[model samples]
Target: MGLAAASSEHAPVAACGFAEATAVLRRLTADDLERVNETILDRMRSRAPMIPELAGHLLRAGGKRIRPMLTLAAARLFGYRGLEHVKLAAAVELIHGATLLHDDVVDGSALRRGAQTANVIWGNKESVLVGDYIFSRAFELMVSAGDLKVLQILSAASGVIAEGEVLQLSTQNNLDATFEMYLAVIEAKTAALFAAAAEAGAVIAGCSEEDAEALRRYGADLGVAYQLVDDALDYSGAEDALGKRVGDDFREGKMTLPVVLALARAEGEETAFWRRVIAEGRQDADDFDRARAIMRRAGAIEDTIGCARRYAETALASLQDVRGAKDEACLRALADLAAASTRRSN
Candidate 1:
């Protein structure tokens, strides 16, 4: 189906985006998520003297907590009642936090969730150390589950994530970044953690290898869709709604999909405009407007959205092997939710 048709057909079935995610997530109670979150926070707080303060600063900022929720919800859907789910959820959240700390430093981000970033409040050295503290605490918390498989899975994903970040940095201004390269970087940098989250849920729940693998695929595809839309929104999203400065990637000389497509279609002055923006990193408000116009003229936004829809479809298809009746429905809804979220304002 085309984008409009897909949106219309899936609207009722998927519950749009946040509504669907909220409904599926409701399977796990607030107390359940909060209990796990508190434990995670407490463990971080209990860390040795000065490090706790640094870690505490970022933790207090608070986020949507979507990663851990994915893990907890998957475990609950599979009938897992053990406390291990709590630890695993905390582990995912901590891992996520560590990445953000590092990302803020790399991106020179001053604010996050309407608060000063650790790097901005504290020094980069302190932010990096506190990030390490969270990583260590996450591993320590993981030991309570006693699953070496989970540890190995998370470890490998973490390595790939770091490598992907470096790769993205390397390709920052090189407008020649291929579509394949873009997908690979996203899978490693962003999707790997999502894959680990869902796979760990199944592992802790004693799910079969097949079912666990299926969930892993689901998370990976969902993450791809999530990040693709994120990059797309950087061009079109309102600054206030995005919760970050707009056109940041372009200003940073980062060549995202929108810019890539615009470059490919550019001719004459348009091509030189892209070169100045991407190569020189010279951008202003009018530059952002012109870039958006260029992207629209080149059909990059629509193309990128189409790719996101494909990933969402793949995510939905991956659930075919899952056995439970609700599992399939919820997973399908989750896929639709992912797809619908691409067009969201926030």
Candidate 2:
């Protein structure tokens, strides 16, 4: 998994190397990501004043832009030189931004990107409406890309994302949630877009189906790894370092992987505690702390991180057959990113 797999061996793949890999990828694709940003700004403009104002607040927020960068990197891997990749990359970002807006409203989140969420500042109704607006803009950008296959991939991913969120809603507050159910939630709600983002770029680059599938699998595994770490971080991460409240998922009764594993390992009194706090949604101020302590004792968080590392390794393996990549550094960074993503503090 070297240049053949994106510097998988060239860089440190330890959990502590996540930030280093992220910075490397950012520096490598700074120019392409900037163009994607420009397209996002251009496409977000609307006659309604509130639309730009609200959209700008979130778009200007300091997100990692990993999804869009996946699109750009896949395109560059296949030596794509056209502006179509830019449009698709911006569309990917728009899709992510729209999801965040909607998710904040659904989760009743107060903070995002270390700032007040749009839903907190503009109201849930406004946030939801603007999320719809952002979705429309993303579709517009996809259509402008004029690649029917890419459109199909992204539109299908969008639908799957919606379906995943609904499935998560159904599973919320259920102490009986299983590992399969949780994996389905993260794969669809998170990994589907990552798969589509990478595949879309390959399609635009006119790559072979094999290479396209490789990138898709790479993104899929990397996305799962990243999301698993995200869920684990909810219980273990620093609020300031993670850019949000640490226990939002617990308060919201999200049946994330860590919760699933912890509940599976619960004893008699532990089961009742989880039922009260998670199943019945009667969390007191100390519930989150108790939940974290329980998870640590059960090694749920450690197992979740370990699982994430396995997925990241799979992501690196998926890149084994990709060919015609012009920049070995981009590929190497991606492999390292997959390895390091599981260890993210955020």
Best by lDDT: 2
**True-structure lDDT of candidate 1:** 0.77
**Which pairs clash in the backbone of model 1?**
none
Candidate 1 lDDT over 126-243, as tens digits, reads 8888888888888888887788998887888889998989989977878778777888889989899988988898778777788789889988998898788888988888887777
Q: Write the per-residue lDDT of candidate 2 for residues 1-346, one digit (tens) a residue.
A: 2354444446444454788888888887799999998888887788888898899999998998999989988898788889899899899999999999999999999998799999988899999999999999999999999999999999999999999999999899988788999999999999999999999988899988888998999999998998999999999999999999899999999999989998889987998999999899998888899999999999999999999989988998888778766777778778778978876777
> What TM-score does model 1 achieve against the real structure?
0.90
Which stretches of model 2 miss by more than 4 angstroms?
1-16
Q: Point out the worst 10-residue segment of candidate 2 by lDDT.
A: 1-10
Among these predicted structures, which one has the highest TM-score?
Answer: 2
